[model samples]
Target: MSFIALHPLRTFSDTWRHRYLLAQLIKRDVLLRYRGAVFGVLWIFLSPLFMLAVFAFVFGNIFQSRWPEQTGGMPFWLLLYCGLIAFNIFAETVSRAPTSVRGYPSFVKKIIFPVHILPVVPVGVALVHGTFNFLVLLAALSWSGNFHAHALLFPLLLLPLLLLALGISWFVAAWGVYIKDMTQIVPMLVQMLMFVSPVFYPASAVPAALRPFYDYNPLGTVIESTRSAVTGQSIDWRAWGVALGFCMAACMLGYAFFQHSRDEFADAL
Candidate 1:
C-alpha cells in the first residue's frame, strides 16, 4: 500500500497544491446550484436574506425571543443571526459531505484526479455562502446601529469550525461512499446539534452542570464566540484555544482515515 502522510502539514500542503482544481470544483458546485433558476446567481444573496426574514419574523416577532446573554442594542433576530450563521457554515458543509465524493464516482475512478480533495469542496462552498451571509449580517447590524469593528472577527472565529467541519466531512464522506446510511444519519445529527448548541439561546442560559460540555463542544464554542465577536464582547480565549486544538486533531485524524480507506473507495463505488 502507498504511504499517505497524515500530518496536519500534509493536509494543508495537499490542499494548497490542488488549489486550482478545488477552485474549479467550488465554482461548478456554486453555479450548478442555481443553474436553471430565473434569478440565477442573485439567489446567493437573496436566499440567505429570505431565510433571515422568515427566522426574524417567526422568532423576533411572533415568539419575541430574548437571549439570556443579550447585550447592547442588538435585537433578538440579529443575535440569532449572528450565532446561526456560524452554525450554518458547519451544518451546510457536513450535511453535504456525505455525497460530496459518493455522488461523483467518475472522479474516484479517474486515476489522474485527486479524490482526497472532494470533501474539501463542500467546505469551500459553505464559505462562499457564509461570506454572503456575513455581508448580509453586517448590513443588518449597521442598519440597526449595532455594527462594531469587532464584527470583523466573524471569519476569525470560524477557523476552528471550518477545521472541525472539514475533518468530519472527510470521515463522513468516506463512510458515505460505503454505508449510504450517513446521508440520512448526518442531517439528523446536524439538526439535533443545532438545538443543543448556542445557535438560538445564549450559552449562559445553560446550567452550571452542563456548561462545561456545552462550552467544550467545538460546534457550540464557535457559535458562542462568534456571537460575542458580533456583540463586541470579550471571548474566553482559553476555551477557544482548546476548541482549536481539538478541531486540528480532528482534521488530521480525519485525513488519515480518508487516506487509509482510499484504496477501498474504487471498489466501493
Candidate 2:
C-alpha cells in the first residue's frame, strides 16, 4: 500500500512538539543581552536602580515637587519604583519585539522553524529582568517601611500590562519583518508612552479635563493600578475594567494580525 503524507494538522503538532526549542531560544536571548557586559546579569538589577536614583534626584529633589498624600505612607520613591517596574516591563517587551524576528534571519531562511515563537523571546527576556526588578522593589519598599500586605498582589495587577505588551509585541514583530523603520519607530513610541503614562508624575497631577485621556490609555491605568496595589492604596475599578478590556482586545487583534502575516515573514526576510 502507498504511504499517506502527513496532513497539515500533523505539521502543527510537530511544531508544538518542538516547544523545547522555543525555551532554548528564549534562554539564548536572555543570555545574549548581557554577553559582553562587565557586570553581566547584575546589570539588569542595577540599571533600573540607577534610573530611579536619577529620576528621584531630578524630580523628587531638583524640582521639589510635593509627593502626593494618598499612598498610605509609602515613600514617593517607592511609589515611583512600583510604577517604574510595570512600565519597564511594558517598554522593554514592546521595544525589543521588533528586533526579535528581525535579528534571527537565519532561522527564517534556513531552518524549519515556527516563526510565531520569535516574538516571545523578548517578552521572556523582559520577564526575567522584571522578576529581578520586582525583588529590588520589594527590598526598597521594606527598607522604606512601606511594604504592605497588598504588595503580594502586585503580580496580579501587572497581568494587564503583560497582556498589553504581548499584544503590541506580536503586532510590531510581524510588521518589523516587512518594514525596517519599525525598529526606530517603536522605541520612540515607547518613550512618548513613558511620559504620557504617569511614570515621573502621578495621574493626580493631571487636570480633570485631561484625565479622561489617561483613563482610556491601558498603559496609564496599568501603571496606576500597579502602584496602588504595591502600596495598599485604592484604584479606580471602572477605569481598570475599561483598560483591561482594551488589553484583551489588543491581544486578540495582535494574535490575529501575527498569524495572518506569519506566512509572509520568510518571504519578507
Candidate 3:
C-alpha cells in the first residue's frame, strides 16, 4: 500500500498549486457578499467611505479627539481610520473563518475539494475590503494635505497581519466544524480584540506598565507601523521584524493543525 505525506510546506504549496481555483473561490465569495444589495459591487467602494464619514462625525466633530503627539498635522479621524483599516482586515477575516468551513458542507462531503483553501476565502475577501479602505484613506490624506510617499508602503506593512489572520483562520475554521458554537463566540472575541488593539487609541495612551504588552502584540505592532506608513512617520522596523517572525510561525503551526484535524471533518459533520 502507498500513502501520501502531508507536510507543513505542502499546506502553502497546495494553495499556490491551485492558485486559479483559489482566485475563483475568492471572487465568488466577494460577489456573494454583496449579491443582493441594490448598489451591488459599488458597496465595496461606498462602505468604507460611509465608515470614514461616521468616524469623522463621531471622533472629529463630536468628541474632538486628538492623538497624544499628533504626527504631521494629520486629523484625528484620518489617524483613527489608518489603524481601523488594519484592524478591520484582521477582524473581518477571523470573525468569518468559523463559518467558512461549517457553512459549506458540499465542499467537504460531496466533492474532492481542498478543504484547507476554504479558510483562505475569508482572508481574500477581507483584503479586498481593506484595499478599498486604503484607497479612501489616501484620498482623505490627499485632501487634508497629509499624503506622503511613505503611504505607498501601507500594503507591504500589512503583510504580517495578513499572515497572522490566515493562520488564525485555518485554526478556527477547523475547530468550527466540530464545535458549532465557535461561529457565535469568535465574533464577540474579535470585537473585544478591536478595543484591546491600538485601533481607536494609540499605544502612547496606554499606561507605562501595560505598554510592554502592546509592544509585543502582533496586531498592535502592525497597526502602529501601518499608521506610521500612512502618516510618513519613522516606522519601528525592529518591532515589525518581531511580528513577522511570530506570524510566520503561527502560519505554519495553524496549517499543521488544520491538516491534522481535517481528517475527522467528514465524520464530525
Candidate 4:
C-alpha cells in the first residue's frame, strides 16, 4: 500500500518548487480578469480609486462618521479605508478559494498539477488588488495630511493576515473540490465577517461587554494595528505577536488538510 505524506513542510517546498508556474498562473489570473473589458487593465487602477471616492463621500460626508477615539481628527473614511484594505485582502481571497479548485477541472483530471498551489493563487490575486488599494490609501493619507512614518510598517503588519488568508484559502479550496455548495456558502460567510469585523468602525466603539470578543478576533487585531501603522498611533505588538502565532499554526493546519484531501479530487471532480 502506498502512503500519502502530510508533512507540513511540503506546503512551503511545493510552493517554492513550483514558484515559476505559480507566477505564470497568477499573472494569467490577473490579466484574464480584465481581458475583455473596454478599459482593460486600467480598471485595476481606476476601480479602487472610484471606490475610495465613494467611501470618502458616503462615510465622510453623508454619514458624518467619526472614530471613537480619533486623536488626529483623521477623516472617518481614511480610518475606515485602512481597515478595509486588510479585510478586503482576506475576504477576496477566501471568497474566491472555493471556485479556485472547482473551476479548473483540467488541472485535476487531465494533467499533472500541484493542486495545493491553486488556493495560493487567489491570495496572490487579492494581494495584487490589495497593493493597488494600499497605494490609493497612501495617497488619501498624504492628501489628508495623516500619513505617518509608521505606515512603512504596514506591509510587515500584514504578515499575519496574509497567512490567515492563505490558510483559509487552502482549506476552502480543498473542501470546494468535494462539496460543491461551498462556493456559495463561503462568500456569504465572508460578507458576514465584514460586518462582524471592525472595518467600518473602531474597536474602541464596541461595547465594553463585547470588547473581549472583538479583541480576540484576529481580523480585528490586524485591522486595529494596521490603522495604527497608518495614523502613527501606538501599535499593540503583544496582540500582533499572538495573532502571528495563531496565523502560522492555522496556515500549517490548512496546508495539511489540503494535501490530505487532494488525492480524492480527481475522482470527486
Candidate 5:
C-alpha cells in the first residue's frame, strides 16, 4: 500500500484541507482536560497563575533571583514569567505530543482518519492555554507598572516557537507510537531544557564556553527574544530570523518523517 506523500507541499495541503476537523479535535482536547473538574475551564487561567505564584515564592522570595544586568523596573518574578510564557508554549505542547497519536488507537485502526492532524491538536491546545497565560502576564505587568506597547508584539515573537514546537511534536508523536519510553523521556528532557534556557536567569549569566550553544539553541533564542518583546527591550532580529529559518526547515523535515512512517501506524497501534 502506498503511504502518504512525504513532500512538505502535500503536508501543508493536507493540513489546510482538514482544518475544520483539526479545529474540532483541538476543541475536544481542551475541553477534555477540564470536563470533570468543578473548576472547569477556569483552570486554564488559574493553573498558570498558581504556577506563577509558586515560581515567584521559590525564586523571587527564597533565592532572591534577578536577571543579570537587570535594567527594567519589572519585578524578578514577572521577568522570569515573561520568558517562561514562551517556554511553556513549547513545553506544554511537547510534553503531550508523545501521546497525541499513540493515545488514539481507534483513530488509527478503526477508521479512515487523517492522523497527521493528531500531533497538531496538542500544539493547538497549547496555544490556547498559552494565550490565556499571556493575558495573565499582561495583567500582572500592568499591575506592576511595567506594561509596554512592545508587549503587543508578544504573539508575533512566538511564531518561530510555534513552528518549532509543531515540528518537534510531529516527530515525537510518530516515534511515540513505536517507543513507549518516549512518553517518559520527553518530559524529563523538556525539564532539562527549561533549566538550560534563559527562563530563570539571563543568557549573559551562562559561562563563556556555553554561550554559543545558548545563542544557537532555537528554543533559547525564542525565549530571549520573547522576553525582550515583553520587557520593551530590543529583540535580536538577526537571531530570530535565523531561528525562524531553522524552525521552518525542521517543520518540513518533521512533516516528511511523520507522513513516511504513518503507513505502519495501523499495524503498530
Candidate 6:
C-alpha cells in the first residue's frame, strides 16, 4: 500500500481537531501560574492594577515631571499603561517560551501529541492576563476622561507584537530543548529588551540618529503604535508598516527554523 505524507497544513488541521486537549493544556498552564499565589487567579487582574497605581502615584504625582507629548492630554500613567499592555505579552511569552517544551518532557516521551503547539501555551496565558490589563486600562482612562475614539485601534496595533512574540517563542522554545541555560538567559534578555523597546519611555527619548532603530525595531513599533491608538495621538504609520512587514517575515523564518530543528528535540532532551 502506498502511503501519503501529510503536509504541514494537514498536520495543523489534525492538531486543531484535538481542541479538547489544547484547552486542557491551556487551563493547566493558566492555573499552575496562580497555584501558590495568595489571591490565586485574582492576581491576574490585581498585579497589573497595583503596578499601574504605583506608577501613577510615583511618576504622575510625586515626581510631577510632565512627560513630553502627552497623548490627548492623558496622564503619563495612562500612556505608560497603553504601552505596557503589549510589552507585557511579549515579556511573558519570551520569558516562558524557553521552558515550555522542556517542562513537559513526559508529554514528548509518553503521549502522541502535536508537540509544536506546546510553545503557544505561555502566549495564551499571557494574552489572558493582557485582556484583564486592557480592561483595567479602559477603566482608568474612562475615569480620567481620556478614553478617546482612537482606543478602537489598539488591537489592530498590537497584531505585530503578537506575531513577533509567536515567532521568538518558537525559536527560543526550540533552542531551550538543547540548552538548559536558556531558562536563565531568556528572562534576563526579555527584561533588557523591555527597557529598550519603549515600554516605560517614549521613542522620542532615543537620540535622533538612534531614532531610526527604534522606528524600525519590531517591538518598539508595536509599543509606540499601541500607545498612540489608546491616546488619540497620530501614529507613525510608516514606522508601523515597517514593523508589520518585519514581524511577518520573522514569523515565517522562525517557523521554518523551528520545524527544521524540531526533529532533533527528542534526541537533545
Reference-based TM-score of each model: 0.96, 0.85, 0.94, 0.94, 0.93, 0.89
lDDT, residue 207, model 5: 98
**Which segments of candidate 3 are over 4 A away from where they belong?**
1-9
Clashing pairs in model 6, backbone N/Cα/C closer than 3 A = none
**Model 6 stretches with alpha carbons more than 4 Å out:** 1-19, 36-38, 69-72
Q: Rank the candidates by lDDT, best first.
A: 1, 3, 5, 4, 6, 2
Give each model's whole-structure lDDT: 0.89, 0.78, 0.89, 0.88, 0.88, 0.80
**Clashes in candidate 4: how many?**
0
Worst 10 residues of 4 by lDDT: 1-10
lDDT, residue 72, candidate 5 = 49
What lDDT does model 5 reach?
A: 0.88
Q: Give Cα distance to truth, residue 63, candidate 3, Å.
A: 2.1
Give the residue spans of candidate 2 off by over 4 A.
Answer: 1-19, 53-64, 68-72
- Give the alpha carbon lDDT tens digit for every residue of 125-171 in model 2: 88888888888888777776778887877777777787789778888
lDDT by residue (tens digit), candidate 6, 1-269: 10121243443454468767877888888898799988999998898899889988987889875556644387887887788889989999889999888988877665467777888777778888988898888889889898888887887888888878877887899999999999999999998888788887888888898887786788988888888888788988888888887887666555666767777777777
- What is candidate 3's lDDT per residue for 23-62, written digit by digit as tens? 9999998898899999999999999999999988998889
Question: What's every prediction's RMSD, in angstroms?
Answer: 1.6, 5.6, 2.5, 2.1, 2.2, 3.6
Clashes of each: 0, 0, 0, 0, 0, 0
Task: Say what the RMSD of model 6 is.
Answer: 3.6
List model 1 lDDT by residue over 1-269, tens digit each: 12355677888898889999999999999999999999998999998899888877998789987777555368888988888789888999999999999999999999888998999999999999999999999998888899989899989989999999999999999899998999999999999999999887888889999998896798888898888889888988788989999999899888888888888898999
Error of 6 at 187 (Å): 1.5
- Residue 229, candidate 2: how far off, in angstroms? 1.3
Error at 95, model 5, angstroms: 1.6
